[model samples]
Target: MTAVTLTADRRRGLQRRIRWIVTATIAYNVLEAVVAITAGSIASSGALIAFGLDSTIEVLSAAAVAWQFTRRDPERWEKPTLRVIAIAFFALAVYVIATSLLALIGRVEAEHSTLGIIVTAMSVVIMPFLSLAERRTGRELGSATAVADSKQTLICTCLSAAVLAGLLLNSLLGWWWADAVAGLVIAGFAVREGIEAWRGDACATSVGMILEGDDHGI
Candidate 1:
């Protein structure tokens, strides 16, 4: 095959792989959200509930990315899909902030959530690498949809870390308010990312974009 043909084939392969990975991640997140919410409700852990909501929003973002990827003309749909993803993130942030504030004002204490901590720890360990890999691959392929998906993964990594920290502090230090405080941090990050994504600015200058000669990669 010619070099052009080889590059096209490689791009197709990468797209397929990214689609599979994102789909799998979304599926797992859906299950995790359900489990986390159930456990959080029983344990009365606000952090766990916020983590579950974050995962649920991630599932929506992943689905949006998948739709963008499979479109016949992704460029035409990119901006709209990204806006929708951004709105989803914004909604999640609003929910987190409201709930966290209520918990803080009421002095509601989170109960022990061993399961929540374990799941969040697992996500913290796995998600950053997945996001970085996807970001690099998306940049190489000049795929905005994939880059957006990578941002969602990065958000997941951050949320997991915050959730884990909140759970740990609450569990070990008996700082009952730590979980709600962490929820506020997560909400702040989510709102920032949501605004960026809504403005079509996510991955504005990602490493992949620099390599691909596109400043507005996502």
Candidate 2:
């Protein structure tokens, strides 16, 4: 095959892989959100609640990617699709910050959550590799949407780490406030990432797309 043909084939394969990953991530996030919420409520763990909200945001981001991929013309859809995802991220950040603040003011103390800790540990183990693979494929294919989705996965990995640490400290040290503190930290990181995604900084790799052209016509 010619170089152009090879590139085209690679793009197709990457897109297919991304689609599958997005679908699985969405499904997993939905289940994760439900479980996180239930576990958080039972344990009164702020970190778990924040983690659940973050998963919900990931679901929204995945939906946006699915929509973008389905478009007949991805280039034409790119800017507007990214804008939609950004808006969703911004809104989620606002909600998370507001609720976290309210909880802090109310002096809420979190209980021990074995289930939340277990789930968070699992996410920490799983998400980083998946995100790195998606990001590598996205760089090869020059798919901004896929890259943005990968960033979301990266954020989830970070959030899982923070949640696990907070839960562990609170459970073992009797530091009831650590979970709420962790939620604040997670919210800060999420807000920063959300703003970056909303402003298009996260998906600004159009240079690759430009070089490759479209439909293997390079």
Candidate 3:
């Protein structure tokens, strides 16, 4: 095959991989949200509930990217899709911060949650592999949306670790406050990712336009 054909084939492969990655992300997050929320309700654990809500936001973010890729001209849809992802991140930050503060002030002591530990532990193992796969493909494809989605997945991994730590600490040492602290950390990461996504949209949009114009001139 010619070099052009090889490049085209590689791009197709990348697109396929991205699709699979985001679809898996959506499926896992949906399952996670349902299970985490259910477990939290049963245990009266604020942290697990907040983690579940974050998983829901992850679903939205991944869905936006999935929709973007479905378009014939995905670049045209980039800005709005990125806005959706950014808004999801901001929503996550706001909720996590507010809930963490309430949990701290109310001296909320979360009951031990065996299910929470198991689910979060599974996420901790699963998410990093998904994020890394998507990240590598995104970089090769020069797809900011895909990269942003991967970052969101990475953050979910962080949250998994946080919730796991919280559950473990509370179970082992009766340190119910650990989860609240972890929630604050999650909030900070969410805000940072949101700002980065919004800023990246502007830069990537400009670059995409330039590349498209060049192709037209060719």
Candidate 1 structure quality by residue, lDDT tens digits, 1-218: 11121255565666676777678778888888997898789898776887798788888888887777787665577678878878877887888788888888998788887788888888888778778877776666655666777887787787788778878887899877776777788778878878877777765443233244222232
Stretches > 4 Å off in candidate 1: 1-6, 205-218
Query: How do the predictions measure up, each by TM-score?
Result: 0.86, 0.84, 0.89
Best by TM-score: 3
Residue pairs whose backbone atoms clash in candidate 1: none
**Tens-digit per-residue lDDT, 98-217, candidate 2:** 666766788667887889988888889878877887776665566666777787788778768877887898789976566556656766776776677666676545624522333532
Best by lDDT: 3
Error of 3 at 23 (Å): 0.5
What's model 1's lDDT at 140?
A: 61
Better of 1 and 3 by lDDT: 3
lDDT of every predicted structure (CA atoms):
0.75, 0.72, 0.82
For candidate 3, give the lDDT of residue 72. 78
TM-score of 2: 0.84
Candidate 2, residue 148: the lDDT equals 72
Q: Whose TM-score is higher: candidate 1's or candidate 3's? A: 3
Q: 133-195, model 3: which lDDT tens digit per residue?
A: 887666556677888888888888998899899899999998988988998998898899888
